[model samples]
Target: MTLPFFVYGTLRPGEPNHDAFLRGRTRTERPARLTDAVLYDGPGYPYAVPEPGGVVHGDLITALPDAYAELLHALDALEEYVPGDPRSLYERIAREVIREPDETPVRAWVYLAAPSIATALRTGGTRIQTGDWHSRNR
Candidate 1:
């Protein structure tokens, strides 16, 4: 199956590392909206989760080379996310994302950060935005 990746952070093809992921490999990139979630500024990035009446707004881009699923999992987990490590902060989950007006729901993966560590969240003075990272130092 072609892995569909839901990009709500730096992977959205404009911020950092955009050239590495989106350059010359994107099949169909479109603005996507996922319901039942919200974006919160985590330690190094943003995270999303299902919240009543909440929605996660981002882009749904088809990544090529096929192995993007594994690659993305590694990249997202490269830092704070660890294999079988409860200490890890981020997690990858396959979720349903609405891509278009008439297109059927598609399966895509998104990295969700643990919200238990709200202390690490930048809740004041630093607002979070979709697909854009304004962090000075992660």
Candidate 2:
């Protein structure tokens, strides 16, 4: 299934990687939020770690049909997500994200911290308390 992508960190609009990767590849982008996830500060990005009651603010991006496969591949490479690789930093998963204003639910691909990374983040990583990477204090 070709679902939209829920981007919470550098991949979101106006962020560093947006133009570099998603600028011409997306057909639509809008405000959205992922439930059960929180953001942790990475060196130059943010990691979304699943947690009960957590809410992550981001964008729901729909890729143009022709760009889907390429976009997916690029994102996987950029995120260092090797399927079934224990050392991968992120894991891409499909989840429901709530669109803003209407509060409608839409299934989208979300990059979450991998198991080990999540474990470390849960124990000692600094969280981006606001759940919005752009709002994090520098």
Candidate 3:
């Protein structure tokens, strides 16, 4: 079965990792949003955490079934998500992402920082109030 992914950081279009990881693997790609999630700067990357009134900007990409596993594995590695590892930098989870312009909701895989990491970021990391990694970094 094919799966969708909500990419907010390096995996978004034009980002350094996009071409390397998703360019030819996606069946569809469009702007999308994950509501109620705060974005924080993690040096070269961005981390997202669930929040009551936050909205994160990103892209929703559908991977072809034939490439899904490989794509997901590559993404997991890129996000440093080691399954069952407490020390993983991010946790891969399924969440509802709203497609942009129309606001249609779809289930998609998303990488989120652990609560403890998010709490630390809240205290010391730079917050991307706009929820746009590209804009904040640029």
Please report the candidate that would top lDDT against the real structure: 2
Residues 20-136, candidate 2: write the lDDT tens digits. Answer: 999999999999999999999998999999999999999999999999999999999999999999989999999999999799999999999999999999999999999999899
Question: Between the candidate structures 1 and 3, which one is better when assessed by lDDT?
Answer: 3
TM-score of each: 0.70, 0.98, 0.95
Better of 1 and 2 by lDDT: 2
lDDT of 1 at 47: 69
Residue-wise lDDT of candidate 3 within 44-108, one digit each (tens)? 88999988889999999999888999998899899989988988889988899999889899998
Q: Please give the clash total of every predicted structure, in order.
A: 1, 0, 0
Best by TM-score: 2
Model 2 poorest 10 in a row by lDDT? 7-16
lDDT at residue 96 of model 3 (Cα atoms)? 91
lDDT of 1 by residue, 1-138 (tens): 456777776776666655665666667777776766667765545667555566676678786666466566555654366656667676667888888666567788766665454334434424344423433245
**TM-score of candidate 2 to 2 decimals:** 0.98
Residue pairs clashing in model 1 are 37-54
